[model samples]
Target: MCENNPVRFIDAFVDGLDLDALGFKRVKPKATGRPGYDPSDMLKLYIYGYLNRVRSSRRLEAETHRNLEVIWLMRQLKPDFKTIADFRKANRTAFREVFRSFVRLCRELDLYGRELLAVDGTRIKAVNNKDRNFTKASLKRDLARLDERLERYLKDMSEADTRDDDGPGGDASAKKLTEKIETMKARRERLAGYQKTLEETGEDQLSLTDPDARAMERNTRVGVGYNIQIAVDAKHKLIAEQQVHNKVSDLGLLTETADAARKTLGVETLDVVADKGYFVIEDVEACEAAGAIPFVPKPQRGSAASKGFFVKDRFRYDAKANHYTCPGGQELTQQGGKRVVRKGVHVIGYQNRRACKNCPLKASCTDAAFRKVTRYEREEVLDRMAERLADRPEILDARRETVEHPFGSIKQWMGQGAFLMKRLDNVRGEFSLTALAYNIRRAITLVGIPTLIDAARA
Candidate 1:
């Protein structure tokens, strides 16, 4: 009888024919002649850490020394903390490939539906704190403070110099103040250089702990360390994730994530849904061009329509004439051939000051001296999109149900709001592993454990 045997769980869970079958090896021929642990054992250690929600390397080291499941899984071998940490850090690229392979296997088994995908970005607290973020505005404030201190030091120095030779201490005080002023000036110049770098670099924000990460506001009252974006399939809620720098807004993320999912699933096209944040006109067009349908809400900024005033939409656009006919039956023509690009469409501005000033509805039409109306050259496309969304309002509700589930579950499981790894590459690698673990758990839950084992064997 195998009753009360602790090894049963480990044997049943992690016993494998060969780690090399999964493209992992225990030894490298190029390394020095030293006793090395098996790569399979390290892989098992990571899997155990992910499964038990002990993601920190140090914590995993502690578990290997004391925890029963870890002891059983690793065969009572306790690797040092440096070894464990080095393994994860050095093998990040290989681990990502392993994650991709698992995703491929899941698709082959028909686990991922690849029909309906929800795209969303959630803020993951970065390893860097908010205080480390150096924006141009912050740098300016720091320089201003330095300038005030320098002025005070100069004033003190001048006062000491004006002293009527009362004591030799006056010269010492003058020299000390002068030195302080020079130090403050040098600091100010350094800050100026930092500010110049901030301006020259296209990145809107930077992180001290992770140079590639950006500090972004998560909500009105809260700020996050980093923003991780994911596109999850509705069928099993398996994550298709990629970490991005926080500077870029969500408006451009829709097509990128959807395209990644399509490529991963080897599908020609798919349906994607997201909130208003992803609703850039160019992104919608790009998704369509990529053969994917994006169901994202158009962001509504308060316009004249919302304020109960005459909006540009009220005016009828004469496409052939390339002009607008106002409500008062006045013709508004394009002025000075000036145009601006909005949402990837050229918007030609039209105005008629003479007609607008004399119209009965001029007060409602213009708060400006002249009434101006801007028409997008591709307004017809936007109109069609709005109509389609109106027809299927339930898509929004579906988006909420599909995308929030995985985010909520992962956040709860992680216990903390931040990432453990510093730097963008490390964070991305960690996230990839987390996503793999999530997909595996989902697959195991949807299909029985025995079925997964059979598929793995097959």
Candidate 2:
């Protein structure tokens, strides 16, 4: 007779896993005395789900019923849907801790070298559809609809009143009309209250499906999604930090992601590279202040430079006199200066058109009879940042290698567009798990599976 065969895929995977060493604890002692499943068994379920690309809790629950690996992992114990979902919901904080522990293990394994870090954000579709997004314009339209209904109801009431009363029926009709009017008024009030809340909050319309997520444009073809940002180390392509935001633009993400990378590495400073989308003058200044060297390409809007016309760069600045010299070597005197608000920030503008009209390059410079140029009062600071970026050409190449690797892997693994979770927090947790899983794969590949198993055992 053949020797009894018992070793299975799940058993092989869990052979060396030490749940306590990984910082996973059993549910509280007071929990209903249902024979508590081992935390390691649950961890095995998640790892199997991630490796097989089965991310849904419901799907994972089904896997326990049929999948051979899952059955072996759970020792033929099929958990109900509530048990699986509750585990994920209640263990969110603990799962985050587990994620950090894995990162520490990766560091111990030298998977991340803290040399070059790249930052980028990708939009993931929320459970909410675009039609659900309520903007000020949409709210106005809704209120107009309510107003029209109210007017029609009032007209009908007037028509009913004009008719001669024949009996008690007329009295009942009038009472019904009054009730209808009261109902309409209540609805109108509710709509008005919603409109006021929208206007005062200063946020774009919200998604009822996922309140924490806001619709954001990802690209020309993709719109209305959550922005998920990640910082990846150049060496071994391990994710250093990650965050989810409702912002459409990357302007505010650069400094925050760079600081996260720095904190993760426990280093004073690090080199951070990002694409043009992440470029913001204020963010650049913040990065410089934090001692992190940021390499972000400036976004070239369809201005003079992009249109082949003379750009501000062609004009030179005079530090001593605090004025700009036109391309034609004419002095642009400050005809007037005033502080003005733009994008919620106060900026000073200087203008001088008298010297521009008579200049030989006026045609290439501007269509106005006189060429007018205004600079941000803090333009000097931005200029210094540009100069710094100009000196580091290698940063652009490093950005390609550092940022794209993890994204390529993740996209290949997860497929394109949207996510498995419906809510923003759930999506975030899912993404965190994905990142943790990817880092684990990287760690295993870098230090060898045997070493990681040994560390996990320790």
Q: What lDDT does each candidate get? A: 0.72, 0.71
- Top-scoring candidate (lDDT): 1
Residue 201, model 1: lDDT of 89
For residue 383, model 1's alpha carbon misses the true position, in angstroms, by: 3.3
lDDT of 1 at 175: 72
- What would the per-residue lDDT of candidate 2 be over residues 28-115, giving only the tens digit for each residue? 2234767766766776677667756887778998999998767866888776666666666554545555555666667766777787
Worst 10 residues of 2 by lDDT: 1-10
How well does each candidate superpose onto the true structure, as a TM-score?
Answer: 0.79, 0.76
lDDT of 1 by residue, 1-458 (tens): 14233233223433443445545545432346867778867877886677568888889999998987788778898887777877777666556565666667678778788888888888877777777777777788999999888888887767766775558576676677778888889989988887878788865555566676665656554453667788888778877545455644676788887887778778898778888888767778778778677777766454666666686667887778878898889999988764667544676788898997778998787677877887665666556666677888987887888877777877786563577888767777677767766777777777756666555555
Candidate 2 residues lying further than 4 Å off, grouped into runs, are 1-44, 65-68, 71-78, 137-197, 302-309, 333-346, 368-372
lDDT of 1 at 326: 89
